[model samples]
Target: MLYAAINAKDHAVYTLSTVHSWRISLSISPPSPLPPSQMTQEQYILASQPNPLQRTGCAQAYPVGIYGWRKRCLYFFILLLLVTMIVNLALTIWILKVMNFTVDGMGNLRVTKEGIRLEGVSEFLLPLYVKEIQSRRDSPLIMQSDRNVTVNARNNIGQLTGQLTVGSEMVEAQCQRFEVRSSDGERVLFSADEQEISIGTEKLKVTGNEGVVFEHSVETSHVRAEPFQDLKLESPTRTLTLEAPKGVEVSAGVGEFKASCRKDLTLESTEGDIFLNANTIRLGNLPHGTTDPLLAPGTTYAKQTVYEVCVCPSGKLYLSPAESASTCQTTNSVCLWS
Candidate 1:
């Protein structure tokens, strides 16, 4: 029985050893250090991670990765700022273009690619020539002056801006409000009321007030007043002076006429006619129309010259004969041969 037991124990021990050997043979072996190609998925992933320069999107969970993320954020912010700046600049340029579209320094007035445009003004005054005046709609320019108002519609559009009142006796151009426009050395003037306006190519003059008058003539381009009155005139030739009495006579030949004083006036001309109108008349020297030694009241009766003179209704006068010193005191005194 003891030997059997011993044999059984030995048998069991052998069986256990054989089973252990079998299990050992079936078990998986511990893996060797990975080779370059045989590395695990985790190891491969770690190795394939990009370098700092090549990295994109999120970095790995490391201090270096955190620094890279901050740098990326900074770059993104800078890019965003650049985009915003570009957008703002575009908007500003657009706004400025829109604001200055209608007006321009070169075209002081309204102008288009097709032609120039002039707005109708109530009044205007100009000292230069007008090269061109383009008007829109049916607005007119009312001009008043003592000088002649010239309308040069040679190449004008006939836009009929307004009418011109020249050499007006009522309103004066000197103290009036007016507007003017000029381009390329050309000027245009406009006014609303009557005015003593002088308009010509070279010069322009205006006269105001009751005694204000203008004289335009082709023969003797002269302007004169009786006394105590303002006269403005422009002519192509010389100036002439004539004197007359209030109730005597008044005359005009041609051209424009103006009177400032009143006196018995007699106007007679051999070649041309005379112009006489209502005006103030001052008792002045008879012949020369100026204060002179010979024209005093108590002077001797020297000689009679042909000149139109003004005498009061019953004023006393001494007429002397040219041959001798004989004086006559008759109303109808004439050299009679009796």
Candidate 2:
């Protein structure tokens, strides 16, 4: 690099050569700055420069404050910044006036004297969970839908306990069992399940405005029926007794009437006679309880064979074998119970 060394007293100039990396120090040979008297103002300024050989035109000429085009650029930048700040402040005021912002509310929802009012439709992307929802005016909460509405009761584990679905034409419920309870919640008015259905408070009475009807047979603990069809009653393991307060009647006018038993059958009447009214009476194989038999007039043996039924005069019965079976006809000798 080349630098000019000027002698102020003679106005002579000298050219000095040095490398760019070395410091620009005229007093480097002696390690002391030059005395102020022999140095002119220009030479003193030239020697005091730390980078005298590298000149960047006006920057090196006037080194303190911004000057010339750079000064103009700094002023223009300050003006532009002020204008930008003014424009931003104006826009901010305009937006505040247009939007009418408030600190107490958010967005379009505003708090008024009556209640809170939301301007647009509020859509929830996720499930809205709330404990209780009610009207502010203490009225019933009215929710209307075009098609169906459903309500579900869930446990803490998110398992559904019950579900009530109401459609346009029908309403359905899903649960294990269903019961209609009384107003006081004491008794069940109606209950239903897969097994049985019960009604009333102990007794069930049908008003039968259209008459009670049974399409098929009904079997319960005490009463049973086959409706208007044929019905039969049988005892499988125990004895069956038919009793009534007044009388028990069994009528088979057009059909045959027959009765048989696996064991012995006894018919006893305490106040009335057991009348057998038929055109003909038939008897099967039987034995009679008797001790004496007729002597056949010649023999005197009491060995009775084929003892027949005989009626006494007192209407009491005792078996006797005369010449033939007789109700009360006694020709030779009459035997009566003693």
Candidate 3:
């Protein structure tokens, strides 16, 4: 559409009109060929600090920083993620320490759903204390320590039941009674206490490689035999000595008493007269005996033929001929005993 228009009657009259137009523009350029004093001007830009670099013309370059919002946000997110991971790791370690987690159980020790377990021997640089231990089976429970091993047992009410202590120099087992049992668990092989020591089997045998000596008397001691069997005491070398300070007496309740010797058997009194008191007195092996001092003439037995019995004042026996019997009775002397 035309901005200037005429009516039909006026359009025929507008043919000779002349057109007029105008143009507009804006600029901040300096004036041409001005004096240096007149060209002095100032411009203020709201921008960041600029870097020190070569500049040209009347314009300056403000330094470019983290370029855009996306880059700055990316860097900040990365830093935040790193901090979060570090904190999570620190907290996990602290929890493990407080709960006593088995970090050392990486090798021989194991941590499982059931509990903490040990697969093999674990030697610690320091002493180990724990609530329990599972060890080998069917073997002796031997514990070794340089100093000592003490075992104490307590009942449910906290009363002590037994105490066993073993050390470098001494060992002690304290209880009312101590028992030793067989591996088969059939019977008690031996049992002892402060007042009694019992041997449950048929016989008790004590032996040693060199010598077995019982030096002190025991309390409530006994040696028993099997059913209907005899209790025997023996020394294989035939050397045994038993002494009592008081006088000795022998009695046979239901059996005959017998005395045996390999050589001479002598009964002598040092300060009293010898007496034989019995319902009937009978001498054995009268003339056939050979322990007479006067008859020991270094000759064989066949060389001596006849002998007589002599009586001494000290009740000792001697041999004499029948013809010297009357003289033997009057020749009584204590020397006849020898």
Tens digit of per-residue lDDT, candidate 3, span 1-338:
12332333212111122223321111122222334554434311111224233235543323433447977898999999999999999999988777556755554556767577665444455646566655647644456776787777777797989989998989899988998888998899899988767878766555544444554443323444445644454566555444445544554456555666788777776887778676987566643324334544442333345665675555566554444324354333333444
Query: Which prediction has the highest lDDT against the true structure?
Result: 2
The CA lDDT of each predicted structure is 0.42, 0.59, 0.55
Better of 1 and 2 by lDDT: 2
Regions more than 4 Å wrong, model 1? 1-73, 79-83, 86-90, 93-113, 116-131, 141-338
Ranking by TM-score: 3, 2, 1
Decreasing lDDT order of the candidates: 2, 3, 1
Best by TM-score: 3
Judge candidate 1 at residue 190 and give its lDDT.
36
In candidate 2, stretches whose alpha carbon ends up further than 4 angstroms from where it belongs are: 1-33, 36-128, 133-138, 201-338
Question: Where is model 2 poorest over a 10-residue stretch in terms of lDDT?
Answer: 23-32
Structural RMSD, model 2? 15.7
Query: lDDT tens string, model 1, 65-131?
Result: 2346887998899999999999999998887676554554222345668665544343446653567
Structure candidate 2, residue pairs in collision: none
Task: Name the regions of candidate 3 deviating beyond 4 angstroms.
Answer: 1-116, 122-142, 201-210, 216-314, 321-327, 335-338
